[model samples]
Each structure stands twice: as structure tokens, then as C-alpha cells.
Target: MFTRFRLASTLAEFLGTAALVLIALVLSEITPVSYFVATSLAITLAAIVFIFGPISGAHFNPAITFGMWTARRIGTLRATAYVAAQMLGGLGAWQLYQYLNDKAVPAQSVTFNTTIWLAEAVGAFVLALGITAAISRAVDSLQWAVTAGATYFVGIMIASTASAGYLNPAVAVGLRSWNAAYVLGPLVGALVAVNLYHLLFSPSAVPVKRKR
Candidate 1:
């Protein structure tokens, strides 16, 4: 039973991440405006969360998985499995995109500087904040989905000023921008966000004042 559950969760992560990356790659090619692309991706992600949240908690991003693991909400082995599945899913989506287009994915030359890193960090921070809030509040899946989508929409808009605003390590890999700024920035942001949420916002973190 445990093994079966693990397999189910892993497969859910794989499929969810693949769907996200595939849509993102297609949107990048078709959508001319950044607003439209961000909107579409946010909607797509909300749908994914609604569909896959019951199965795998709908992480679909390594940054979220890392945050959960850091908060001790997820086990180490499971987190590793989810991250591996997400990366493979992104790669699989890229392959599918190439096959569908019958052309090579375009290479983008993005310089990674402190500004870009900070932008990515900020994006991930917003995303992580919403996620942790949902978990802490134990909101229903539908509400969580909306919160996730809204956060992604705002995060992408904020990050796109200095970067492509992948905001997701898996999506970055799919888009062929697997650099430190795209990877480490989000992870660091998630780490800080998770810790901050637990330390300052989580219910258990609140201090109870004694009656005077």
C-alpha cells in the first residue's frame, strides 16, 4: 500500500509538471504579450492544482517541494522523488514540444546578474508565501488553487521585469534556461519564505498573551 501510494504521488507530480511545462512552452511560442502568457499559465496551474492536488499535493515545482521538506511537512526521500520526477517531466515536455514543432527549440541568451537573481527570488517568494499560507490555513483545494494562480500571476509579472520569470526550476529547464539564477534563486526564495511563514505567520508561531 505504501509503495502504491508513493508511485501514485510520483506519477501525479510527473504528469502535472509535464502538463505545466508543455503549456508554458506552447504559450511562449504563441502568446505575444507577457500579460496574456502569465494569465494563461496561471489559469493552467490552477487547473492542475485542482486536478492533482488530491493525488500529490500539486507541487509540480521543486521550489515548493523543497519548502515543504524544509518545513518537515514532507519526508526527504519523497521530496527527492518529486524533484526527480519534476525535472524528468520538464525534459519530457521539451521533447514533446520539439516533436510537435519538428524544429529545434530556440536558444535564449540571458545574462544572469544579481538583478535577475533578485527578480527570480522575489517571484518565488510570492509563490511560496501563498502556498504556505494555504497549507497553514488548511483551505480547501479550490481556494488553494485560486490563491496559487493569483500568486503566480503576480509573481511572473514582477519577475519578468528582469528575467523571463520562469519562477519554476522545472519550467526553466523546459525553456532551456537552466542556469543558477533560474534554479538557485527560486530555491533560496522558497527556503526563506517557508521559514518566514512558519516563524511569523503560522498559527503555532503566535504567542498567547497571559491574562493581566
Candidate 2:
């Protein structure tokens, strides 16, 4: 499987991530729907996972790609490709959202403070860990859904104060196109969160029995 990285799978990863970013931008721009944006994101995540889980592991996020890479679920080269795909996919999504909504500039904001940055870091850590756990089968579908829903809910709640609780660095980069100046605080926070998550919940640290 490591030697074979099919174009279909690669594009699927791109499409899945693209769809998610598109929905997120639309929700953030068309409506200040707040937590509803989180719900939409969660729904998109579930859809992506269900559709592309078997193919490319449906990572769609760089943090997740890092977590899985560290966990030995994927190789370094594939991880790099996956991250590239996710970033490009997110950018593509934003562009498409702009085209559809007829809005040249996406609704962009960066309200960063120490506490807010910490909140973003912690939120991102939890979100990545939750995604890892779900994909790892550490939790059942019901629990996975709950965890994902709650993560987005909490992320959205703290968003206005924390650069919209963006948990993915790739996402931050994607948002940067709309505004040339992107906030560094949340970006650093997100990277720190993923690394911390690896330290806390990496597979080597948290062993499990093989499924029969």
C-alpha cells in the first residue's frame, strides 16, 4: 500500500477536504451562524470520513496527517503528499465558495490574545486527538460523533475571540488568501496542539489489542 498512491485516492482526499473548506467558508460568510458552523463542519467531516475513510484515511487536515504519521499509520512521503493535498484542497474550496457566493473577499478576522491563543491550542489538541481516537477505533461511532460534535461546538463558541478556533494550520493558510496577513498566534497554537496530542496519545504510548 505504501508504494501505491493512486491519483483517485489523492484527488478524493483533495475533494473531501475541499468540500469541507467550502462549507466552512460559506457558513462563516453567508451567516454568522456560530455553533451552527461547527455543526456543518462536523457533518462534513462525517460525510468525508464515511466516503473516503477506506481511501487515503480521509485525513483532510495537516494536524491529523501529522498525528497519523507520528503514529506510524502512514509513511513520511505519503504524509507529505496528504498535507499538500489538504492545503491545496482547502484553497480550492475557498476559491469555489467565493465564486458561488459572488464574494471576492471572504469574511476574515483575527482577534488574538494570550488566553484566546491558548484556547485555540487546547481546542485544536482535543480536536485532533478526538479524530485520531475515532479513526483508531478507540471509541465507537456514537462516541466518535459526540466527540466530534462537541469539539466543533466548543471551537465555534470560542471562535470570535480566537481566530474562529481554527484547529488546522493548513486551514489557517487557506484562510490567508482572503487576507494577506494571517495571524501567527493561532497557527503556532495549532501546531503546538498537534505535537502535544502526539505526546499524549500516540499509538506507541497507548497500546491496544488487535481486533480479532
RMSD per model, one decimal: 2.0, 4.5
Stretches of model 2 off by over 4 angstroms after superposition: 1-5, 106-113, 138-150, 158-161, 177-212
lDDT of 1 by residue, 40-125 (tens): 99998899888888788888999989988998989999999999999999999999999999987876657667888999999999
Please, what are the lDDT tens digits per residue for candidate 2 over residues 56-100? 666677767766676567788788888788889988877776677
RMSD of 1: 2.0
Clash pairs of candidate 1? none
- Which of the numbered candidates is closest to the native, going by highest lDDT? 1
Candidate 1 residue-wise lDDT at 125 = 94
Cα lDDT of candidate 1 equals 0.90
Please report, in order, the local distance difference test score of every candidate based on alpha carbons: 0.90, 0.64
After best superposition, candidate 2 residue 120: deviation in angstroms? Answer: 2.2
